[model samples]
Target: MYVPVSLLFFFIGTALFVYYKTQPGLLPETVTGDQVFPYFIVNGLPAGFTGLLIAAIFAAGMSTVSTSINSSATVVLTDFFNVTSHSEADEKRKMNILHATSVILGALGVGVGLAMMSVKSALDAWWSMAAIFSGGMLGLFFLGYIARGIKGSYAFVGVICGVLLIAWMSLSRQTVFHNYLTIVLGTLVIFTVGMLLAIAGSRLKKGN
Candidate 1:
């Protein structure tokens, strides 16, 4: 799946690049990344093909949304609910919670989609938002996976520090780092501080 998807994107990107290079006048001067595919379809493709492309795009979006909702529901059910509880009542309650979670997530997704309608550049906005949201999360995951001695307390501190750093970078008007580097910076800060704190605590414990 991954390989095929990667190759598909590669070919599509190559085609887009070649098209832009050969026919630079086709795109408007103020056009954005998000508008490229739609612009191409509207201007280049025949009416029948355009409809098909639009339908395919809609189907892909629906597929992604359904998959996300299902995954979210499953995670909420499995992680929060007591799977060991075999009673029918417990099962019903868990099922209720799962459905509720799915509904809430779907609503949130809709809200976000509406909000993004106001954004000028969807691609940039998405990348920036993803970085902000996943920065601390991915940091903690990497720290836990790579570092052997990091305890929960150290991890907690690291998460706090990472969140604070990302917040500062995001909110500061004079920030020097590019938007794309935000996640990388946050992950590094968390892992480095978490590991150092863990090592220090270990040494202090041995000395004591």
Candidate 2:
């Protein structure tokens, strides 16, 4: 990340970030957002740096929206339809359904994002709330991954627990941990509950 030392520090900082992001995902989730943005801004960056930051912000939002739409649509098409479509003749129909789903979801995300802008900006507690409930999701994957016992019917129970855990964490106003840590704690709790359910399921199966 060294530069000619002759160039302004702002330019050097910009160069270094572009170089860094090019190399794998650089630091963990926290550091990645931090280092580059601050370095360029505090050092009195050029106009281009401001442009880049704005672009990066919008790009992040767009990518998030796109991914959400695509994922939701995929779940509806694959899991929901795969259950009942049992014939070769239905494959073509399913493909059409998937195409329709993708378009509809994409449109919905754009529409909702625009519509919700008023709500998003009006709230002061959004960032705190963001951190408070951030970690509920990682729990689902943890149970669905390491603990082989959690599967099938018991999986839904675990998911419900994850949602409830987030709700409890958010409403309690107990911001003991930062947003990132909140996610880890929430995930851990949900994973434990899910595992217990899976274990009980195993016991019932063995008794039967």
How high is each candidate's TM-score?
Answer: 0.78, 0.48
lDDT of 2 at 24: 41
Off by over 4 Å in 1: 1-14, 17-21, 28-30, 83-89, 136-146, 170-172
Best by TM-score: 1
- 122-147: candidate 1 lDDT, tens digit per residue: 75676566666667998899999998
Instruction: Supply every candidate's count of residue pairs whose N, Cα or C atoms clash at under 3 angstroms.
Output: 0, 2
Q: lDDT of all predictions, in order shown? A: 0.83, 0.66
Q: Write the per-residue lDDT of candidate 2 for residues 72-175, one digit (tens) a residue.
A: 87798768877766755366777788779988888876785686566533232464455445555677777777887567566667666666666665556675
Single out the weakest 10-residue window by summed lDDT for candidate 2: 119-128
Give the clash total for candidate 2. Answer: 2
Please list all clashing residue pairs in model 1, or write none if there are none: none
Error of 2 at 114 (Å): 2.5
Task: Give candidate 2 regions above 4 Å deviation.
Answer: 1-75, 89-95, 119-137, 141-146, 167-181, 199-208
